[model samples]
Target: MKELERIIHDDSNGLDYILVGEVYLPLLAVPNETREIGFYGSLHRNYLKDYKSGLYSYLSLSGKLWSYLADVNEQCVERRDYLMDQMMEQEGITEELKSRDQMEWVRRANNVRSRVDEIILNEMVYV
Candidate 1:
């Protein structure tokens, strides 16, 4: 388990019981690029069905959050891919390379990042 998971699991505070599931659900979902994030506790067979039920509950309760997170993850992947391409281009390999592809990817990545960043930052500031 990750250090964060360990900390959450070992926490004795009341807050742990309240927020542990919430925190880990998003963390697991984000890293795995999965919209279904409530299955972390289903590693054991006993909890498998319960895990699915929890997943359904989470999705029903916060489908928008999952969609937003997935979109953000997609944008991040696009940005990383574009940056990798830019690095490759800068290394002077151009004969078979397509500048249009490079430009489009970079622009898409930047646009996604800018929009998402604006939304997130504004929400943070106002909240």
Candidate 2:
């Protein structure tokens, strides 16, 4: 327990236990008989369960959700790259399709790149 306290207090490995402790501290301060105590206690217990094991794992729900979004965005970019490669290969072999529709394929590929840029800027930069 002392080691946990030391790690939490020192923000070791960028763990922000101060944030988690701040939420739970007030519950510990209030009398147990109070009506709200049980509710707050349950919430604190949930926090403990969620955060007790791993270092730097106590991020709020929004942070976790954003992390998930970033992961999905990465996968989307990878798939887009693979599909664009296939399209480019097809364009090289097909003269009619290359003449009439290559620019459209370029536009779609640009759109995918733009979406990946937007995701990196908006969703991944902060996370």
Candidate 3:
């Protein structure tokens, strides 16, 4: 009757509950994080699942895995960009080089990309 209110707040746990049928169920909803978990996030997720099971479990259980992965993805992307810019500047990989010696530019660009990828994997993604 009066005790079965439509909604309620619990001070002990600081949570809200909605009355559903004969029980009050804890209100829950998925977070509205818009960032997509890209390649780096996927790599980090796999590493955590395979090697860091305890941390993975804690993050998943606490409803923070997605947000954490998204943040990692952002950081990885920024790091990749910064590294690429530095390597490109140092190697003189430019539009002029790309237009003139296409093959050489391709080779150097590929090397830079692979190196940057390895650095990110070891420094950010895997650990």
Candidate 4:
């Protein structure tokens, strides 16, 4: 009788298995992504799972889902910030006004954020 090796590879399935104590378990590797996904990324992830299941599966299998989501999050945050700044400037939403009328500033900023969120969802997440 021969003892089984610590690690073995199957030729037919091309999978590697490792002996853990008394059991041989398939060796699975985690995806090589370390990006911290935030709200936008989470939204995109849900959208992918719900609306684009095939694409979500492909991305997950290919180990590119995290990086892709991180990229989208970064792009959305950057675009939102840039647009917010531009809209603020155009709408005269200055710090001086904020200091003078805090309530009005809050209202305008809330409106800007709402618009940005809608645009981002339509262009990135829901698509």
lDDT of 3 by residue, 3-109 (tens): 67898999997778998998899886557788888999999999999999999997886578899999999999999999999999999999899999999999999
Who wins the TM-score comparison?
A: 3
Please give the range of 10 consecutive residues that has the lowest summed lDDT in model 3.
26-35
lDDT of model 3 at position 110: 94
Q: Write the per-residue lDDT of candidate 4 for residues 54-82, one digit (tens) a residue.
A: 99998886668899999989988898898
Candidate 2 off by > 4 Å: 1-62, 93-127
Ranking by lDDT: 3, 4, 2, 1
Superposing all C-alpha atoms, what RMSD in Å does each candidate have to the true structure? 16.9, 15.4, 3.0, 3.6
Task: Compare the candidates by lDDT and give the number of the best one.
Answer: 3
Give one digit per residue, the lDDT tens place, for model 1 in 1-127: 5444333433453222224643643223222335532222122222323545564455534434445344444544455556555655665445443464777565655665566445543342122
Candidate 3 residues lying further than 4 Å off, grouped into runs, are 1-28
Worst 10 residues of 2 by lDDT: 25-34
Q: Which candidate, 3 or 4, would have the higher TM-score against the true structure? A: 3
- TM-score order, best first, reads 3, 4, 2, 1
User: What are the lDDT figures for the candidates, one per model?
Assistant: 0.43, 0.43, 0.92, 0.88
Please give the distance, in angstroms, between residue 14's alpha carbon in candidate 4 and its true position after superposition.
9.7
